[model samples]
Target: MRVSRTFRLPAAAVGLSLTAVLTLTACGSDNATDTAAGPLTVVASTNVWGSVAQSVAGDKVEVTSIITEPSSDPHSFETTPSDAAKVSDASLVVYNGGGYDPFVEDVLSSNGGNSDQRTVNAFGLLESQSQVRDQGEANEHVWYDVGTVDATAQAIADELGELDPGNAATYQANADTFSGRLKQITAVTDGIAATQGGAPVAQTEPIAHYLLEESSVRDVTPEGFTSAVENGNDPAAADIAATRQLFTDKQVRALVYNVQTDDDVTRDVRATAEAAGIPVVEVNETLPEGLDYIQWQTNTAKALAAALQ
Candidate 1:
């Protein structure tokens, strides 16, 4: 028998039409099975979570991430039969829940073999750790928060241990080491808070909101503008004008642009910021190729710090 859990979508996810949610829920087949051998197989919705699992599991598990390209928008990712197959074969499946990757849930649900698998929903884990609440108010970019990521690493280690008890000690050690690196990443934010705290910044979306908050940077982007962009709607004319003025008037120290979800308005805003000589820092929702979770996040923090300077 397969076990299923109910996850409340974040408030922002309410925009996903009921039909779309139902469609996702109805995807995949119940005949899925774990076919891989030897080491445990892990499937992550995106490389951000995949990297964390890889770090904790080390050479003990083979991890596959569905969303790897930085140019891909995870929100619009379409699941395929291949992805379903990977989910089917995995001993562990990790995903960003809070509707960040509802398709993952759908795939697991339709595929019945997951009852014996270890599944880690980062959003749920963060909620259990008190790093966030299930009030549907939290941002889906939980990886941007160091504390949340640390907790997620520990959770992955624990789950991997349960699946492969022979290497439990090694997994715990790796997780502890990974947690220390996360602390170093947090230190970058601490340094920024000490020197550039309260610096006004702008964003095309809330993709990096958690990191900005940790760094003590004030996000001065118009909420309406960001909400419009995030929801795939045109920003209000007044909101656009107000945001453009923030750049032109040098009111914001930096413009943190989302590289994955560029649109005409966002492009215009970026060009406007550049024209006004405001530094623009590019951020992505997924981890880029070749860089692990710690490297990607640490580099992002360094870039933000440099831009603020």
Candidate 2:
């Protein structure tokens, strides 16, 4: 797969509507399977959770991710009726809730079969475990939260075990193995935390809130700038100037750039950081092609650590 930058327009520019589902049949059996008679199936909101579900599922179940393309942002994902059908028919549905992938919730809410379908919501799991460490508002990107990702993997195993009792032990063992690897990934951040605690950085958005927080790096980006970027609105002139000052004044050690949501303003900020000799660590919301969850996250943590060093 080719690795290239994906510059996305504002979410509002891409209309978030279920018009295709309305025009097409609302309940077709495209890629939908019967778990009782045929192979068990798991549907995830995006490949990030899908990779976790697949790790726990092993070879016993078929996992499908609605947003498979690296360029597709789950926040603005447009679901179809066929995608709804897959969710309804799946033995288990894994998603990142907490308003991250509202389309998944919209599909489940509209489908009557959702009542019988099993689900593992990563954000919901984090809330239930009281693992949200943000001061006021929680970050919806729970996949970046290592602990939450571990919990989500185990939750998928539990759900799959209940659905396919014969493979319960296999599911549990796979989840354990997956969790072990996740620990290794966490250790990298822990190392960074111990050595680079309180080191200041800048972000184009709060995409890596959990990872950066875990590593104990301070985000010096103005709240107004990140908030505006996340909301798909341009920041005020003062907010923009404040953010640029972080780079020009050498207040930040690095810039955590989300490569998926690029725009002119963010591009300019990145350029400023580059010109100031601040290392920029690029991150993605979805899994890059040809790489699994562990590999992708390991790269992220290592990249952050290297940038800090």
Candidate 3:
């Protein structure tokens, strides 16, 4: 099958009133026969994406996520040679584009994995990550947004369904359930948007920008967020001063930040936010274990809403 020349706009757009489910379950029959059922093999870029795929693929696909450890950060990730072999062997691979997981793109370009393998680039499918030019001390954590996650889930389900026709019904059903939760999360985010306005926010990277943007909370974030994220280091004193002053000056409504990586500067920023009574929406480097991707995301969304309001 020929790859699409460009990412297609997902069926659901921003600000829409709910959406249809497109979840795909892992490929297999319930009788412990999926191993014998010849499930579609998959490799996902992030653990969160892997969970989303599992929710949709239920028993239809075998998904192996590249990152599963809680300490893993996409910005700091370095793909190993063994990772390449796993990706190359898969019938399908799902990754978030827009420089989120550059390694995934590298594997696809050089390895020439499978000519017919379905490659789902969720960032490419939904929005133009091209014009999205902000990676500062603010992390580039886009998966926190419900819509983006939902779009990624739909893409996985659609492709898995195409690859395994026999279990399409199960996949669709699972996708439906996942989609419903996403919609509910969206509503929760909307409520957050309604309550909070003009919040001063700063972070170590642009990781939560998409979700921040979705919430419509004013980010009086310092310019350092963008600069520090680009350099992969802490911001300069002046930028930090400006960020801190937002609180001292009483110009900030909240502080949205990443608490995954240990950095004195980020910790300082959090200190400033706390001292100023500014709520800090701390986002993890990735989804934690035990909770599904949807639950993980909703957890962050709830934090954002609380901080903003």
Report the number of the highest-lDDT candidate.
2
Tens-digit lDDT track of model 1 for 1-309:
111112233222323343343344334322123333445688999989999989998998888999887665556555666676677557788888877777777666655433665688888766776644432357777889787788888988888887777899999999999998887688899999999999999999888988998898999999999888887778999999999999999999999998877878999999999999999999988878778888888899999999999
- Candidate 1 lands at a TM-score of 0.86
Reference-based lDDT, each prediction: 0.79, 0.81, 0.64
For candidate 2, lDDT tens digit of each residue in 183-292? 87889999999999999999988999989988989988999998888777789999999999999999999999988888889999999999999999999888998999
Q: Any idea what lDDT model 3 has?
A: 0.64
**By descending lDDT, how would the candidates be arranged?**
2, 1, 3
What local lDDT score does residue 118 receive in model 3, on the 0 to 100 scale?
64
- RMSD of every candidate to native, in Å, equals 6.6, 4.5, 10.9
Q: Rank the candidates by TM-score, best first.
A: 2, 1, 3
**For each predicted model, how many residue pairs clash, with residues at least 3 apart or on different chains?**
0, 0, 34
TM-score against truth, every candidate: 0.86, 0.89, 0.79
Query: What digit string (tens of lDDT, one per residue) describes model 3 on residues 76-144?
Result: 455666676566556779887766676666555544323455687777655543346443332334576
- Which prediction has more favorable lDDT, 2 or 3? 2
Instruction: Please give the lDDT score at residue 66 for candidate 2.
Output: 89
